[model samples]
Target: MRMALRALPLAFALAPLTAALTPIDALAQPNPAKMTFFITSAGLGNGADLGGLAGADQHCAMLAKAAGAGEHIWHAYLSTSATDGKPAVNARDRIGTGPWYNATGVMIAQSVAHLHDSTANTGKQTSLDEKGGMVNGRGDTPNTHDILTGSTPDGRAYPPGTDTTCNNWTSSGDGSARVGHHDRQGGGEFPTSWNAAHPSRGCSQDNLKASGGAALFYCFGIN
Candidate 1:
């Protein structure tokens, strides 16, 4: 019994050392079954077009399903301005009353109010992708810190005249979309705003790429 107790202490001491050497892909990607928040591992590959909000939501769901997180209803963190026949939508309104968690089970926000406020725990480290991988950010070889948001700093849609959503996420070649810095750095009206940093140069694949983005966006589980 004494020998067993001594072994337990030694084993506990070595556990962290063992974990330190574990490959990122092997153990870094943790329980997606409980994930409630993630940046899409991949985009629709159409710049800011995103096939509109429905298509973006579908993309989120598909990626979540692939990552074993399909049990929840996923929504893209996007907003649409009021148009001729359509009412405006808020990105904050679509996602559930938060307490959202990342793929590694790290909480991003405790509530919707918290998420849009200064107290939310979101940034390069906590804002992980669907597979718990870090999205490239400022100072990375090729920066992809600009995350599509299409919402204001408060997470609401812009007024009717603005083309913040890239023509409601349909016209990828003409207008521009508002984007956030997932790394919570860089230049903008609200430079550190995780949901509304600045507008993209334009809504094309090349433009987004050049502007430090790869057409990636945030996703949240509503159920």
Candidate 2:
């Protein structure tokens, strides 16, 4: 009886601590099903200049890590144009070969071809963020539907000519970036294109907003 009394206080003291840790423990467990696709809830503040492709990839990895989905290799869906003798890079080539899913366990695409197909399973409905939250679209308040892709409608690098990638995602000052409509809504040409809507007037964050964007992009897990 004396021993039981002594243990009672200890149990009571530890109960709240264990209760506080319950949710954290649940979140810390690596999801066995895992996440494979997400639209970044935010972006690097320097406009479309994601410090080039490497920096963009790092951003994807960082966001995935924060969301407890860091086990898989993450890649940003952004294209780079060849300039100053450098070779061009396609956004399609960087992401892994498909079968991506949103945080809510919803599959986005089964393969690369399927991802770019007109019937792709992605859009405002499936293209959720790391938290499985819906991003605002063309008809939503503020209308942040434009997502940065920098690739053509076919997911290839733009031909050498006018700056179609904010100087290959390195300039947030004076260059322009190609954007897409995640909502598949109005953009005049390619209004229904999910990954290729139109271009930004300039590379600044405000400029991206002018075209109905919040400087966001898509991230995919390769592994």
Candidate 3:
């Protein structure tokens, strides 16, 4: 993993603290999964209908299982417009409210959609040009891209630690800070660390390359 300059010193300080702890005690401790994470495009489509709530219950069940969620809830939503200025809304508006639920049929993640002209693709699973949106035309289409926020199953946000940027901050004309190629085909995990630092911007397709389409995920805290 590429260590950030600011995080390096903190990482070193924490190492010794960990060493002082008992191995068995640490090993036995359960690593709690946070409630927030970027849902895949496939997750959104499979989870909900355009405006109906019937499909979401089933979808959240599947999401909880796939994500190894413990007493946690998962959710999905649709976009009202296309990145290319096309009318995305159709008959699926009634099911806009999510079918949120827990492991035992208790509702957790709620469903909602935001309309924006973002160039970020909420589908696909590969790198692409900064301008290309989510990759649905290609193989393995995703359902939608969402900005992650809210409390965990137990209700907690991932702690802030590093700077996160999609496509290395290229989409909005931010200069490149990292060396990896932009994931144009979507289905990439939004950086939790970056989300903590730049919550106002949410997740964007700014730095992603334009040759291939990709989605953006952003993490944030529940109000």
**lDDT tens digits, residues 76-155, model 3?**
32212222343322212422344322222222234423211123222223211111123233233332222222112111
> Which candidate has the highest TM-score of all?
1
The candidate, 2 or 3, that scores higher on TM-score is: 2
lDDT of 1 by residue, 1-223 (tens): 9899989989999999888777654546678888999998777888999999999999999999999999999999999989989899999999999789999887889999999889899999989999888999999978999999899988999988779999888877999999999999999788898989999999999999998999999999998
Candidate number that wins on lDDT, 2 or 3: 2
Give TM per candidate.
Answer: 0.89, 0.84, 0.24
Shift of residue 136 alpha carbon in model 3, Å:
16
- Candidate 2 TM-score to native: 0.84
If both were scored by TM-score, which would come out higher, candidate 1 or candidate 3? 1
Best by lDDT: 1
